[model samples]
Target: MELKWTDTLDIAIELDEAHPDVDPQYIRFTDLHRWVTELEGFNDDPERSNEKILEAIQMTWIEEKD
Candidate 1:
């Protein structure tokens, strides 16, 4: 089945969010695009790193699960 992104979750699951001490710096669009292309085989993929992007933006809901 083809994968399609929906706004079911506020934070996208495909992205990788980063939380650091310094001010948050989102991943470059080029890098993100490449990663998405490699993973999903799409160059203009938005979901790519979006969840992480959201996490980088606001990491609150995610819990520390082991």
Candidate 2:
């Protein structure tokens, strides 16, 4: 499925799988933003994301890692 900024949970899961060694809690928003955009099937406008959306994705990723 195509991923959008609103797909925080799904994006997190994908990130968790893509970078199993990563600790999402410590990820910078810049890196997170790049990673999300690089994800397979991610087709949303990169410019559409903001701090709040990045935070949600990070939080969900942290949860998924746990």
Candidate 3:
């Protein structure tokens, strides 16, 4: 399934799986933005994302990690 900016939880899951060695708690928004756009099945416009969206994704990723 194609991923969108609204797919925070799913995106978090993908990130967790894709970067198993990375710590989501320490990731910067800039790198997070790049990673999300590069993810497989991600099809949302990168420009549509804001700080809030990135925060949600990061929070979900942290949850996934734990």
Best-matching candidate per lDDT: 3
- In the order shown, the candidates' Cα RMSDs to the true structure are 7.6, 0.5, 0.5
Summing lDDT over every window of 10 consecutive residues in candidate 3, give the lowest-scoring window: 57-66
For model 2 the local lDDT of residue 59 reads 89
The CA lDDT at 27 in model 3 is: 99
Per-residue accuracy of model 3 over 1-66 as CA lDDT, tens digit each: 899999999999999989999999999999999999999999989999999999999999999888
lDDT of 2: 0.94
Superposed model 1: Cα runs more than 4 Å off: 4-11, 17-25, 40-66
Q: TM per model?
A: 0.30, 0.97, 0.97
- Model 1 C-alpha lDDT per residue in residues 12-37, reported as the tens digit of each score: 23333222222224445465344334
- Runs of candidate 3 exceeding 4 Å displacement: none
Query: Could you tell me which 10 consecutive residues in candidate 1 have the lowest summed lDDT?
Result: 57-66
Model 1 superposed RMSD (Cα):
7.6
